[model samples]
Target: MLSKAFPRRMTVFVLVMLLVEFLDEFTFGVTETAWPFIRNELDLNYAQIGLLIGIPLFLANFIEPIFGLLADTPRRRLVMVGGGIMYGVALLWVASSQSYAMMMLALILLMPASGAFIGTAQASLMDHEPDRHDQNMARWTFAGSVGMVIGPLALGAFLLIGSGWRPLLVLIGGLMMLAAFIVWRLPANAALRSHASDADDAGEPEYGLMDNARLALGALKRPAIWRWLILLQFSDLMLDVLFSYLALYFVDVVGVGEAQAGLAVAVWSSVGLLGDFLLIPLLERIQGLAYLRISVVAELILYPAFLLVDDITLKLVILGIIGLFNAGWYAILSGKLYSALPGQSGIALTLGNVGGLFGSLIPALVGIVASHYGLQAAMWVMLAGPVVLFIGLPWRTDKPIKLEESAAK
Candidate 1:
């Protein structure tokens, strides 16, 4: 039973998980919520502002797989700790920046720092308990939802108190520092230590940076993996496009105030807590990938409904449903991918992040299209994602790659 397996250790794990999620969500929320104020202060336009928002995601996605490969080594802990410290320092830099160029530079540095910790944490979670991948990942997802719920409200409240962007930036940096501290204190589980010692004893070939690239490229060669990648990309694009623009959409298109729209986005995100908690266990009882396919199809059908609806009540309800579908997809899909690449969770998840990174780029294109075409037209373009997913459907369960459990034993 999970209760019997490291009661104290599990508690620490959960706490650290929550801390990481909190820091990640808080950084995103503070940056997003503070955007208008920053734009006004710096006299930046939509294109420049979009670059500021999208650049970190672009860079982070690229670096995550590389970080994931490094996590396979004993040096994972050092990378994680250093990354967390760098992330905190970057946020502090962002908070103190006086000019647009300075803030942009800070954002570029922030991306890799954040990716390091984020990449290592997921790999660590799976490494700590390979058998409990789904349950632990569900918990991780839950923590992320909580962070998403808290972050926007905290930023909004900070802004309301006339604290300006500095306070929000400092708050994120402080949370990241707290996260680094928690991660630093976590004891290396027996499995990880054993893996390290075995590698040292056996004199396994050390993978250099080029070898890491080759491994990632080799994983991508499998067709089933690419199918999963495409599905993940589409889902990520849908989520990013909605999230990146939802505030503006609520204010301009839906005729709501900024505060109310922000609250709505928060509510939209908060509902994900329920989805993660409830959907993961239920889907685990069934086949994970099968459930994911259904959920993805449902999301495709529901997301475009946002374009047709105008009533705030209906829109909120639709958004809530969308959140449910969206949250379930990540929890289920990540679990499925992790299971598929049992020995290579770090590399696989990182590649998945890479797919998400490419997906993140879609919103920038969406924004460009939306500028010329209607927002509805841009959304319609997103609809093609689901259609593609439906067409590129996998026929059978991808066989799980067996790993040496005794190495863990």
Candidate 2:
């Protein structure tokens, strides 16, 4: 029987993980908020700034599978701590950067470290309590929601106190260090260690680079996984594109100041947290594919509303609703993806991250479109992505499968 304390400890671990995510996400938000300042200081153009922002995500996504493969090894905790240290150093480098090229190099190097830590942390949590997978995962998702809320707000508040970006970067670096310490302190499980040793004793074939590639390709070839991946990619694009530029859009296009824009973004993230909270219970009632279909339909309405409305207040309302709906989709889809590939959670998550990387490109592309064409044009282009998601709903083969049944199989 599971101890009552187990849930509490899991919650604490998840919160600690969220703190790490907050720091990681804060770097992006801080950079977004500080970009105008950095641009003026560095004499950078829009294209250069865009590259700086997009490159880290591109690198992180590309390297995630490699990290994922390493995560399946027995030394996950060590990898996580080392990755955290590297990420912290990278952030400090960014804080000290004096040139565009230097900043780019810092971000590219830091991203893989960050990606590794994220994969390790997630794998650790899932492996910690495999029996309580859904509940634990919900807790993890909740923590991420909290982090998303805090990251932008903290950046905005810190910027208000000091104009220079150094203070903000240093603050984030400190948080990352703290996260690394917590990760280091996580108790080792004898059962997990024994399981790994037993598996090794059995002389199971070691998975190499080719094996990893084949597993990823095998995952992609599944029609069910493919459908979910498509939906995930489209939805992620819509969300990432918004986050990457929402602050800028409000500040530059909507004539709002940095503080107000940051607040709006914070509200956007907060509402997403609320959405995830609501989703916890809702998930009990609906299948993963059902949630995906509903979310897609809701987004179709919300996406157009987001673009069509110009009122600042109305825009915030629309963004809040969108955030709430968006929260449910990822968790639910993640559950589905895990179901699609039983007994391979680590690789499944890595493949999902890869899908997310492809999804992230859509927003970067939107940024370029906005730069060349118009902001509204970029927004209009994104509408089609979600619409296509809805169109593909009929093709998905996902249905509710009881956890016990999945485990038995």
Candidate 3:
């Protein structure tokens, strides 16, 4: 029943979904770049700033499973469009917030919207090209890497002109709305409604909240799943948590100008973009887990060096290399995890979010430590992340659980 042009349409659909991912991470990247200014303007303490950053992810722990369930339903396109629009509105709310409580509230709304868009988009990608999970994920993350690079630069341009954070927020909001509109106008088949109907006819089970919960629990029971979840937690702590605070660290500790600090953040992302671009070729030759192991070990060496070095330029160079090695980790782990749970991609991703629940606490904990001992000391906490990742990753490769075989139970 599919048209001859379905492959082209699917490619276009994936590009649109990548744009959605771009907008989401771009917003977060802008937020990270703007954090120091926001902190100064609002007189926020480290703990409050941490709360601003961490609470949304903490809430997403619960919210992701709900969206994950929606991804399994016929309303997937609605979820993607509606969630993208809500995220845009939430960014406007963030722009208008005058208090820490208001900022936190805006972020809380932002997280679920993001979760809805992300869960559905990933599901749609897998649904369209079931055999190409690794390649598709690489493409997905590559788009996000490009966004992360551009986001800070865009914000930096605004900062250079003295337009400040509010205008940047407004700009990101507008982009998200535009992304939503594009998704809404996609054709019925592009939205994969026919695929959903076919699966329903084929007797694939409909997942209510209880069904989602059961699947999530079953996912948790698998050792491979939990190990990968733990690996994701540590990986996020190392890369994302570190990134969110990097600009602040540069401004507060390294005595850099604010715009320069934003540039530092941009450099990290730019190198990551390069690394992701290079990853496409490497993936063709290397196994995902093997690549992950090598990358993690490299981070073990470079992360400490970046933290300990006193020269600003040298440190920035080290950060760039760190981003290079950090490139394929999420794609690999995600591809492997999804492979282990073929039909249950939503639950698999939700289980990763469950790990994110605890991982989200690291920012707040680091904030508390920074408040007392300084950010330099707070950064030392990051050492544990890679160590945990290296130890916890399923290195042996023989233990992957086949969730599709037992998902009914």
Candidate 4:
């Protein structure tokens, strides 16, 4: 009875989980746009910016595994709830920061908090529909894309209102606090009867923290897990690493001001929003890996053209196309990681964090290149993302069964 009524019983559970992704990306969207302004106010240079971004990510890889281990425990709610509170607090700390060190300290705190809150929700979502990992990830990515669209636009709006990134972050932080309260208010009753109550999300945990950690680390030995994990990091060069540098590139190299730079980021994210929305349905008709083969090729061409274009308007157009091509990159790649480690989404999250420890340095590396050779020179490094994807992706993998065929059965 509970299994049959699960979706009905736990609609709120799914919604809350998706909302966490939204807030996480929303923070990114705003912060990514605010970087140029943040640099201006703080008088920061590229190397300093690199450290500000890299060190936190380096440390968070160590911290996030702890939370991933906690995801299946009796304390899952407390962990998530506390993570949400800290998420808000960390953002507020950024808003209050007066020095580069203070802001850096806040981001270091923010990353792990995000890993705990958002990572737990993502793992639960993957566990919720173990059989439809790609499909569910598409849905999750769509939710996040909406926030990505809202993020820069919200920052732009704040700038228009004589407020700025700091005030906008304050608003985003307050919303996180509200999200935490709602997380707290949900009663752990029959509500988790379906999607939420599945052993992945709400059942009594089967392993202690150390046991879970051991299992998660053990899974890393599988080539299947390593393949997706490595690809995930490499692909991110064009996805996130590219996005992080975009505003600065626009400001310094493209001859644009902060407002226009925000617009460029908005255009990138809005097209990504469209792509994410379209991908949810597209996944039904084609294999996720099949889609990746096509999209990666397209991005290989588009990303280079984006950097070479002399006109900002043409650059925006190219960026939108690149965003479109890369829409399902994270969704499909991560879904594969979960599939590779079946029944272990929490472990998959840990694996991703571990993998991230290396990729996290990519931005700082890019920043160093930009500082030495200039931002335009550094932009070319992003091309490595697609080049590796073209080489590393297995031409033949995934079960022979098509998703549409699986659905019919």
Candidate 5:
């Protein structure tokens, strides 16, 4: 579709970047949805589930900056393809794992692998079309949402075929490899598409790694950088972290069975896909910050309602609405972050990874709170996602962003 709309150079770049994000999230949807079965089989408790999710996030975030840095270099194809290969192998390892230790090893490998491939791919997109950050991120998010929607549905189909999560994941692993092959084969452009960074990011290719590290670190001095990065992690509470726990909440808190639980998750992802698809045009019609401000306020009302509701059907309905309202949070926030650090898409990834260091522990913390106080009690922690977003976004939403100017305020 994009190839028809764009020139030859932009066509291949958009397809590859979108494909990478799509498959990356498709696997996440599968892993998260498969949690109940995995928990039952492994006899794991809530905290352990949290540990499994959290520990990998924690470790991966610290390591991901290196990949982000590498992505801004002349050898980006090597970095991107290498990450894709490792990501696929890690998925296969996860499929073959029968024990907690084995799963942990695979997940630890999986997280950094995603940073290398998915995060780097996103960085590539951010580097192109310096003015279209919001519009491009919206397309990127939409692609990911399509993958996310398909993931659980794929799991459901496999379940109907009398196969377990393991087999489904194995197939997804193979699909991931195919995605990597596409990326590897995509034609490179002379316009710094994916193989190299823009001039602002690559001061001198021959400069040592330490020099690049220092330059990325310089992004920290801008207050605008921290604002968006912090909001990104906080936003995940209502976003990915919620997705991580959604299946468990349905099964444990709502008392729905496995099939119903899968349907509930699918409903959330499907509506989210709708929202992301709509956001691309919305970005063109309105300023990104204005849309974010509206979304954040709506999240405050819906998130609490989502927690307090008891009926499974009503909850699913509200869940879809929640997904709808929060749809553009990532696309807009990240777009603004990229806007703030124009031409340094890799630096955006590096800063985002670092900011998420502590936030990665949130899932585990939620699990612990659930274990001690029950899932309902622990669920309140998610409200912080909206609460913080409401406060974190700048008060003045009417104007276009001058992030460098605002960062100092």
Candidate 6:
């Protein structure tokens, strides 16, 4: 039986993870917030801008599997510490970058650094209490939401006050370095470690690169897994990539000032944060798949309204409600995927990375379309995202093996 102390320890771990995520996201948020300014300063074309965002994310997909593999080991916590440091350093590098090539190099470094912490962190959370995976993931998303809320607002404030964007990078880098220190000092929770030891004792074959590769290849044979990947990639188009462009969209298309656009992003995140908080309790009442289906349907309706509606305040309100509905899709999706794969956290996370890689292309694709057809027309492409989700992902999933228990078999 798990000790009562495990929950307390897990709580501490989650809090520390929250701080780390805040710092990580603040750095990324700075980049996103500064992007419009960066585009203007660099005089970059849409395709060039797309490459800037897409290439680093694409490279990160390759790194995620390796990090996922590492997450399954005893050194998972230590890996997060290293990742935090790398993330900070990369942000500093981005701060000093004078050319597109230099910025590109710095972003490339950021991707692997991110992979180091993210999958490991998720594995840690789920391993702490498999039964509470959904709740725990809600908290995980909540933490990220907090960071997302703070990041753009901070950058926006700086921009509003005439401090410019580069200083925000330096500030974020310093905070990231602090986050690394905090993670390094984090107490090791015995429950997750014990689970690791139990799996080792159960004579699970040590998975090497080749073994993991074989598993990944074998996973492709399952329609459910790849189907989930496709759905997720499209969902990201609306959820992730769409937000990435939100500030710029408001500025360029909606005829808003940069600061207001920043606020729009902040509104989106703030509501999402509250929604994540609510989602914890809501999960008790609503089934995960059903909730996801409902949320997607809501988005299917809300997104078009957001585009067609002229009032910025109304648009903000719509985005907040959309945030509320979309809150738990990732948590549910990740929990289900992890449940399906059992011990293969690395492969499961790698699948997300693969989806993210394709999803990264959406920004570039939108940029290309926007260049020819205009920004408003480009956004119409996003409608395909929810439509795909509704079509591809079903409301029911096959029973998934609990990886921790299966390890003992």
lDDT of each: 0.70, 0.68, 0.80, 0.83, 0.83, 0.75
Cα lDDT tens digits for candidate 1, 1-409 = 6678668437677567556866786667656655656767888755666677677678778766777777666667777888899999999998888888998899888988887877677777776566666666777777777777777888777777877768778877887877887777776553232245645543444455566556666667667677778876776555556677777667657788878788778867878778877865675487665766787789778977876887888888888887777675555556667766665666676788767777767767776676677555666766766677677657676776432331223
Model 1 per-residue lDDT at 27: 68
**Tens digit of lDDT per residue, candidate 5, span 1-409?**
7876567325767877898899988988998999999999988999999999999999999899887777656666777888888888999999999899999999999999988888888887876566788899999999999999999999988888999899988887887778778877877642233434444344433333455577676668766677888899999999999999999999998898988889889999999999999998888798887888888888889888888888777888999999999998999888888887665677678888998897899999999999999988998899999899888898652333332344445
Ten-residue region with minimum lDDT total, candidate 2: 189-198
Query: For residues 6-110, what per-residue lDDT tens digits would candidate 6 score against the true structure?
Result: 665467777776666666666666677778888887778777777888888887888777776666555567777788788878888888888888888998898
Residue pairs whose backbone atoms clash in candidate 5? none
Hey, what RMSD does candidate 2 come out at? 4.2
TM-score of 6: 0.89
Residues 1-409 of candidate 2 have per-residue lDDT tens digits of 3797757555666666656665666576566656666777778755566677677778788877777765555555676788898888888998888899998899888878887776667666665555444555565677677766766666666666775677778777777877887888865542122245534553433455555556666666556777767776776655656677777677777788877887778888788889777777676676556776777788889978987788989988898888877776556555566666554556676787777676656656776777897665666776765686678665455563432344345
Instruction: Give per-residue lDDT, candidate 3, residue 249.
Output: 92
lDDT (Cα, 0-100) at 398 in candidate 2: 58
Q: Given candidate 1, what's the lDDT at residue 219?
A: 69
Worst 10 residues of 1 by lDDT: 400-409
Off by over 4 Å in 6: 1-10, 189-206, 401-409
| Evaluation by TM-score, superior candidate among 1 and 3 | 3
Ranking by TM-score: 3, 5, 4, 6, 1, 2
lDDT for model 6, on a 0 to 1 scale?
0.75
Segments in model 2 whose C-alpha atoms lie over 4 Å from true places:
1-15, 129-135, 190-214, 394-409
Structure candidate 4, residue pairs in collision: 6-194
Model 1, residue pairs in steric clash: none
Worst 10 residues of 5 by lDDT: 397-406
Q: Which stretches in model 1 have alpha-carbon errors above 4 Å?
A: 1-9, 190-213, 374-376, 393-395, 402-409
Tens digits of per-residue lDDT, candidate 3, 1-409, equal 4887556435787888788878777887888888988998888988888888888879877877777766666666787888889988998999999888898899999888888876677777765665667777888788888888888888878877979789889878888888888877886652344355656543556566566677677777777777777777777867888988899899999889987897789889999999988887778787777888888899999989998899999999999999999998888778777776766666666776778889888888888899899998998888787788788876565444545456655
Error of 3 at 66 (Å): 0.9
